[model samples]
Target: MEQTQSLVLVITTVETASDAGVLSRALVGLSLAACVQIDGPITSHYRWAGEVQQSSEFRLMIKSSLSAWPELRDQIAKLHPYDEPEIIMTFIDDSSEGYRNWVIDQTT
Candidate 1:
């Protein structure tokens, strides 16, 4: 069957493992995301509030369909602690056929 919606990988960073866990569960439980992989205590260096800041953060790699992007983004924005959080989406042009189908099945 031809796919109407493209798969995407959404990336975001959170302050702690607890926050990561919360986001991962919410997205998957709500069916906005098929899977969420959390990785880190990775170090981040960026400018915030007119100053350079450094911190340890956890990264959430969320898998979902482009069709679900809006709701997923909105939900993350609401639950995220940062006034402006990092929510970036990348289109998945290729993947294992079975895995791709699984993502479609889980999200829809």
Candidate 2:
């Protein structure tokens, strides 16, 4: 039996809502992502270039297909304002039938 590809969750954080909106719109507009959910004003604490850093950020959780990874990544890199943007990815083993099918349909 062949395995079916499921939906994927791509998470990233940006410094501002405008940045989040820009990325969201660009990804969806370019068909790189089926949908992008923005939520936050969360505080992030991390180390950057050997220094401790802290900041308030908004998060974007993008829904896309596994097959769309390469194009999505490239598009985010080209369009993201950050020199090193946070791009975290997790494969969703399962999801709602309606949502999963909707994601595939939108991307297609």
Candidate 3:
């Protein structure tokens, strides 16, 4: 049996909502992502440069196909502000049929 390709949700955080909007637009415009949802001014606590740090950040949930992953990663690397931006990918194991089809149609 052949393995099936599924959608992925790419998550990242930025300092401001404006950055989220900019990055989201670029991703969609370039066909790198089908949809991008921005959420938060949520609190983040993490270690950076060996120092513990805390900050408010906006999170971006980007929806795209697995095939687009590489270019999407590259694009985020180019556009993200943090020296080491939080770019994480999670495979979407299941979703509504309509929504899944929409994602596939939206992304190349």
Using Cα atoms with residue i matched to residue i, what is each candidate's TM-score against the true structure? 0.95, 0.92, 0.93
- Clashes in candidate 3: how many? 0
Query: Which model, 2 or 3, shows the larger TM-score?
Result: 3
Order the candidates by lDDT, highest first: 1, 3, 2
> Mind sharing the TM-score for model 2?
0.92
Which stretches in model 2 have alpha-carbon errors above 4 Å?
1-4
- The segments of candidate 1 whose C-alpha lies over 4 angstroms from its true place after superposition are 1-3
Computed on alpha carbons, the lDDT of every model, listed in order, comes to 0.91, 0.86, 0.89
Tens-digit per-residue lDDT, 68-97, candidate 1: 888999999998988999999998998888
Task: Report clash pairs, candidate 2.
Answer: none
Flag clash pairs in model 3.
none
Q: Model 3 — TM-score against the truth?
A: 0.93
Q: Which numbered prediction scores highest in TM-score against the true structure? A: 1
Clashes of 2: 0
The RMSD of every model to the true structure, in order and in angstroms, is: 1.4, 1.6, 1.6
Task: Encode model 3's per-residue lDDT on 2-60: one tens digit a residue.
Answer: 12347899999999999999999999999989999999999999988899999999999
